[model samples]
Target: MNLSPLQAISPVDGRYRNTTQDLAQYFSEYGLIKYRVFVEIEYFIALCDINLPGLTAFDKANYNKLREVYLNFGETDAQEIKDTEKVTNHDVKAVEYFIKKKFDDLGFPDFKEFIHFGLTSQDINNTAIPYTFKLALNEVYYPKISSLIEKLKELATAWKDVPLLAHTHGQPASPTKLGKEFLVFAERLEIQLNSLKTIPNNAKFGGATGNFNAHHIAYPATNWVDFSNNFVNNTLGLNRAQHTTQIEHYDQFAAQCDALKRINNIIIDLDRDIWTYISKNYFKQKIKEGEVGSSAMPHKVNPIDFENAEGNAGLANALFEFFAAKLPISRLQRDLTDSTVLRNVGVPMAHTVISISSTLKGLNKILLNEEVITADLENNWAVVAEAIQTILRREAYPNPYEALKDLTRTNQKITADTMAVFIDGLKISAALKEELKQITPYNYTGVF
Candidate 1:
């Protein structure tokens, strides 16, 4: 079968391919080959700049031409490298061989040997993956999520004065403003985004055993550690891990996953809250003409966007949990487990993108049902008991908490008249009774 979106197995590559196509340039097989080629070429160029013994004759003017090998890399080049990998059975080695062939075609056979000098498969794999991963986040993920945060801020600011009947333990409690509630999520997301910024995009660039053994053995006088650090950090814009066995230690990778999981959890929290709000009839969705809410029910308008966002966020978090717990561990120095697991990094990212998009869609669909909301506030007169009790306590009244609790905890439905009657019978003075009556659920919302 031709591998089109319809034929692909994973929904990310199939049903939702359009939602996550931006990630293809960072995590696809072709993307991996392209990055591997980039790292190999750049490493060779850096060596030329360093005056490595046999590389002094390399023409600096041809550097642009060398860079073009990867910068202008295309599908044909990627497929050729795949063909080479079929024979070598080593992906990174195949990338090196492909670069060597490019050098021969470019008429630089004398300099081709330095293309991947003194590097292991992990050196290339680790460096390329981290660099590409950072780009994907900075370019795609951050912008998408930040857009959601901005939308939330917009909602919060716009609805700041809209009173909300707050619920605690699924029962009416104190009242809060709608806008202030959204600010809660904006605050959480901002904190997580800051944490993500603190973590450096890290990679491992040492030779065989994280010691640069081959490079050191070849050039004892050279400062290989400083060289690798500068090349990985300054050149590639990633921090190089100083020590490892045969592969990147993956501690930072785990940290990245944990941070992202916390972010996804926050999004899930937002989804669930919005879903609940819609269920409670506090909000109505905009009618998209011809959109079906249910197969049979004509009056139904389901909160499917929030539901979709919640499900995808959950899926993303599960993979993130596995990544956080599993990637940092290796069976005595190295294992094949990380290799296979690492490839799926894009899967969680795709889900996250889809979830954020769903959330954005849901946010845009919301049309405040003020009639229903106002009716809820008007009906829940007992919610103002906390405000009345606090005022009575401020007036030095005795047993104020017990007074309001006894009035509110009854089986009888508390109305404005019921509260007024109860307050009139209170042991407090007339001024205090007047103050207690002033409290109403609609205006009793806490300061935003």
Candidate 2:
């Protein structure tokens, strides 16, 4: 059968294709090929800039043309490399041959040999993958995350004064402002985002065994170690791992994955809270016409967007955990395990993007049920026990905790009138009584 969304195996590429389409520029097969070409071209330029003995003879004016190989790279260029890969049976080698073919086409036959120079597949893979991630983070991930945070901030400010009955252990406890609840998420996300920023986009760039053996042997007089460091760090905008085996250490990469997982976990927490609030009628969704919330029951507007966000966040976290745990480990020096695993780096991120989109949708559809929130707060006059007990203690009342506990724990429903009557019978002064009477759930939200 022809390729269809239903026919695809992974939902990232299938069911949520539109939500994750931007990931294709960073994590797809073509993206990998393009990055490999980018690394190769950049490395060649770095070599030229180093003023290597043989490279000094090349025409510096053609540098723009040289960069065009990658800058203007397209599907046809990718197909050409794939064709070459069929002959070479090695992906990185195909990139080398494709660059050489480009040089030959441009009549720079002497420069062809320097295309790949002394590099291994992991050298290209490590640099290319991290470079892709750095660009994607700057261009895609950060923007999306920033947008989500901004949306959260907008909601927080919009609902700042709105009082919400706080729930602790699934029971109404105290009162908190709705905006403050959203600010909690905004704060958590900002902290994680700062942590994410601290994680360096590192890459390995030494020779086959990360020893620079070929570079050393080829030009013993040249400081190839320093050269590799400068090329990886200065030219490519990645931190250079000085010591390694055949591949990158992946410790930093793992840290990044864990960071993303933590951020997603925070979003998951927010999703669950929002879902609970929706269930409690603290939030009512803006229902669309002809949309059925439940098939059997006509009166239903489910929190499916938050549910979808939660489910996708869980999937993203699972994959991110695997990446964090598995990528950093390999049989001494090198292994092929990381190669296949690295291909799916975008999968978790794609799911994260989907979750973010779903969450934004959920936030937009929510219509805060202010009447229900106010009614709940007004009815739960028992929440004021904490304040009353504190005031009682201030007046040197004996066993204030026991007094409030006895008054609140019974089967009687606590209301504003009942609390006022109880306060009127207290042994405290009339001034204290009046002060206590002024405390209502609506105005009892401790701080802004």
Candidate 3:
């Protein structure tokens, strides 16, 4: 049985492989191994730069060669590390062995022992994962989100003056410009995205028990705390958690997940609203030839893109919820719960990527049915009752609300003509009557 899309379990890696291929460089097993290699090599270089007593004998000229082991790491290197893991029975230990093998190959065997000195698996895992996430956010996720935002902005500007009948409690109540409604989503996404930017890509770097217990024991004279902080903050470009158990506190990571969830939630809201608009005939989809909308009905052009986006967004939010709620709660010192869960960090992000792609597709398919929108507003003349009554009140017309209510209610099909005729018969002055008559559903929209 050869590997195929059908053979894979998760849809993100399987059915939707093309949609999420970019994430593989940051979240795949190969990506993880490569990141581990990067961290190990960087740690070794940092130690050498610190000019530790025992490590001072290494050749400075060979530093570039040592860095190349990871800089040019490939599938063969990753597979070699996996093979080493089989013997060591520890992932990080395997990385250390792999680096030692590289050093031996490069004729710097004496410097091999310092490859991963005084570091726990979490130290490697924490830094590598967050670094991968940070790069992925900058390289992949942020671009997709920004593209979606730009698409929404374009639609907002394009449809700024296109009137849409507003629905309140499932009934037509007023009218609003279609573009302004899109701007609402753009505003929501921008705020949440800014918050995500503020969340520091934090990582854990202390030794076994969140304190550099072993490092401090090995070199009592060195300021291990300052060293750890600098290595994590300056070298890796991540925020260092000064105090912790064996793992990162994940508070900031949880903050990031929650923020992503909120953004996905907003997309879900947009999906549902757009789906409703499609259903109400305010929008029609530009169909692709040979695409099936339904198995049974031939006269169907369903909003599957929005539906697909909604479903994927829901799945992403569920995983994000678990990540936010569960990752931050571990037993007293440390636990293995977060380890397994953290590996799937890319799952929610993959789903989010899928949803964003689907949403973009949906946005492209939509062709605004302006005629239907205007017709809906023109037919719902009773909506302007509020506007007319307010003006009547301003003119000191007694019983204005009661009069409009009587005229609108029990009149199942109110039209612009009916409202105009009724306004002309009002006892108010001709000027007030003309003002009331001028108020149509189209112009009754509060503000564009």
Candidate 4:
């Protein structure tokens, strides 16, 4: 059968392809191959810049021509590399050969040997993977997360004055501003996202076994370490791991995984809260004309968007947890386990994109059911008992805590009139009684 979205085995490419397709440029097979080619070409160009032996005679004008090998890279170029991979049984080796072929075609055949010279497969894989991951976050993931945060801020600002009956351990506890609640999530997400940005995109580039074994043996007098540092750091804009085995240590990458998992966890928390709000009629979803919430139910507008976001964020977090725990450890110097696992880095990323988009969609659809929110505040007048008790404590009222607890902690419903009657019965000044009676769920919401 022909390849299509429907034929994809993973939902990232299948069920939610449209939501995640933007990531294909960074995480797809073609994307990796293209980056590998780019790294090889740039490494060769870097060698030429250093006037490394025979490369000194190479024409500087052909640098752009060399860059075009990857700048103009397409599916056909990737397929050519894949076909070469089938013949060589090595992915990075195929990339090297492909670049050599490009050199021959571009009339720089004599200098072709310098492409990916003295490098192990991990060198290309590590550098190319991190570079692509960095670009993906900067170009795609960060923007999506920022959009969600901005949406939360916008909602928070809009609802800043609206009072909500805050729940503690599934019971009404105090009144809080609706906007303040939204701002809490916005602040949490922004802080985590800032932390995530601080982790450097690191890559291992010191040839086989990370000692420049081949490059150093070929030129014993040259400082390969400094050369690699300049190439990886300056040319590629990535941090080079100073010490390593066959592959990168993945410590920073693991930290990134943990950070992303934290962000997804926050999204999950927001999803559950909004879902609960919908359930309690504090918010209503803006329904389309013909949309059906459930097949069996005729009158239902379920919080499916939040549910979708929660489910996808959970899946992303699970993969992120595994990556954080697994990628940082390998048997001794190297192992094949991380190689296959690294390929799926895009899976969790794609899911995260889906979740963020779903969350934005859910946020857009929500309409504040102000009447219900107001009614809830009115019905939960017992929440004002805390304010009254605190004020009474300031006034040095005898047994104020016990008094409010006795009045609130009972089967008897606490109402405005009940609070007023209790306040009138208090053995305090008439002015103090008026101050206590003024406390209500509506205006008793604490400051942000």
Candidate 5:
């Protein structure tokens, strides 16, 4: 079938295409070919700059022309490569042939042999994938998630003084500020983001194996190790693995997945909490005209955005866990497994982007029902037992814990009148009783 969003197989490309469209330039097959062409062209130009014997005659003026092959790479160019792949039966070799044809057209046919000289398919695949992956995270993922954190900060500051009854073990416990709860997520996201920054975008760039065997054999006197390091690290701006098999070790990539999984978990936690708050009537979502929350119930306005976020983030977390575990292992020298799995890197990322967008939407739609929150605090007056017990302990009252426990553990609800009557009957000074009476759920919120 001719592909449109509706006709696409995966929802990442179908139902949620708009949410993940930006990633097309980084993870799509066209994107992979474009990046391979870029690396090959840059490697050739770098060889020319180093005064490599065969490439010394390459014209410097045509460097921009070479760069344009990728900079202005179009669908036609990618299709041509794909057609070549059908004949060559090797994707990387097709990329090589396509670049060689571009060199011939650029009038540098003599220097075309230096295009993929002394490099393996892994060199191009590993370098190109990491290069684009880093760009995708920086350009797309970081900005979206950073905005979510900023939104949390905004909400936290706006509701900084709003009192919320804390729940422990599904029972009313101490009181907490609504804003402080929002701030907790922001703090967690920022810490994980910092850790994600520390991990290097690693790549493998040696020849066929971890060693520059071909390059060293061709130029025995030249330091090919330094050459590879400079090309992979300084030129391309990635970390070169000093040792590898036919492909990258992907250790740092696994670390990256683990870090992202933690981030997704935090987002899932926030989704569940916000969903609970909505269910408790502590948050009311702004209803849009003509929007249906439920088909049968007209008054229904579901917390669908948070629910969507929770589901997508959970799916992304599962994929991330698998990537972390699977990418680090290969049979002996190498296997085809990593290649197949690597193609789906965009799948989890697409889900993650969708979840982040959904969360931000859910947050924007929420309208806090402060009166409901306040009523909850007022109804849960027994939470003040802890404060009363602590104050009684300060006075060195005997059996203070047992005293408050006895008063609160009764079947009757602990309302303001109930506590007041109990305080009036206490065998303590009137001044101390008055001080204890001041403790209420609203004002008992601890310092953030």
Candidate 6:
């Protein structure tokens, strides 16, 4: 029972470990502990900068030495903290003791007491969690999403001129460019992404119970609010939540979750559409020499890639929804509910990464069946009836909609020849009849 990828309980660490291992640096236990140590060290440095009482005369030359506690943090350092956690039974306090131990080893025993002075565990946990989350998005999540969008744009641009029989209400309605359809999802994703960027990576920094209870009591004359703001914002590059309970209000965090869910939803939409396209033979998946689509069906080249993306997107969104709904609520000034839930923040993100990667793989494998796409357009010539009818309306033709409806709905197979015959039979002038006859599914894709 040694620890290995196969022994992991969650698929993020088990089956898809390689796909999501990049996130381990942000949301793993070691990542959180490392962040806690970082925040404590930086807080001590910030106190030195402010010339806070006894800490004012602290040596500036040891700043880099203090930073090295977390900068050179590694598996050994993490193991030491975990070992410390075993003794203290408090994760953040373990980080405090670990940093103090590092200070003691650095021969700065007098400076060790200020490592976590006047702060509750939440101050460390909340700040470290948000900071880690923000860095994960900037360093990992956003880049993945942007890469997907860029892939979509490439395909959309490549297929911009290809006409597709558009489906509305489960019926062929009009002709649209294949690229325009993809652009819809791309545009939607980009909009939500812009909004996601605006949301502050906020953290709860007050000592305990939302007020600087310990902070104010320790230094009554000092402006702890402004000090906390500067430390959280300028020092840590995160927004300080002005009001809170024992933890962050999580309103902005919930907003971030909702925004990620929105992006996942857009990918889900694209997955279903591409799956349908593959089903309809508009896309033929590239087959590996020995790949099996199904064990029983020898000829099946199924749309499994899009299906995988869709399934993972669904899972990601579900967890993201829970994060949005559950993180923003607590019993009172504090509760233990969000603690365990927050630990899984990387789970949804990992799934999202796997899903998007699947989607990209699916997109790359698609060999467009132009023959099938064009044949579909040809078979659905009845779609041109709208264009003809609209033109007839412009010409003041009597009952144009009724006329096209009667002509198209009778179901005598609205092929090219039949459409031509119907156009020739119209009471309009020959020139107008010829003009109406020119409308076809291929040429009817409107301008962008």
Alpha-carbon runs more than 4 Å astray in model 2: 1-6
Model 6, CA-based lDDT: 0.90
User: Can you write out model 2's per-residue Cα lDDT over 1-448, one digit (the tens) per residue?
Assistant: 6667778899988999989888888898899999999899889888898888789988888889899998999988998999989999999999999899899999899988988888888899999999999988888889998988999999999999998899898888889999999999999999999999999999999888999888888888999888888888988999999899999999999999999999999999999999999989999999899999998889988899999999999999999999989988989889899999999989999989999999999999999899999899988999999999998998899998898899899999999888999899888889999999999888889878
* Worst 10-residue lDDT window, candidate 5: 50-59
Query: Native-vs-model 2 lDDT?
Result: 0.91
TM of each candidate vs. truth: 0.98, 0.98, 0.97, 0.99, 0.99, 0.98
Residue 173 accuracy (lDDT) in model 3: 85
lDDT of each: 0.91, 0.91, 0.90, 0.93, 0.93, 0.90
Give the worst 10-residue stretch by lDDT in candidate 6: 213-222
Q: TM-score of predicted model 1?
A: 0.98
Candidate 4 lDDT over 180-230, as tens digits, reads: 999999999999999999999999998878899999889888899999999
Q: Which portions of model 1 show Cα errors greater than 4 Å?
A: none
For 76-190, candidate 5 gives per-residue lDDT tens digits of 9999999999999999999999998988888888888888999999999999999999999999999999999999999999999999999999999999999999999999999
Which pairs, if any, clash in model 2? none
Error of 5 at 209 (Å): 1.0
Clashing pairs in 5: none
TM-score head-to-head 4 vs 6, winner: 4
Q: Pairs clashing in candidate 1?
A: none
Candidate 5: list runs displaced more than 4 Å. Answer: none
TM-score of 3: 0.97
Q: Judge candidate 2 at residue 92 and give its lDDT.
A: 92
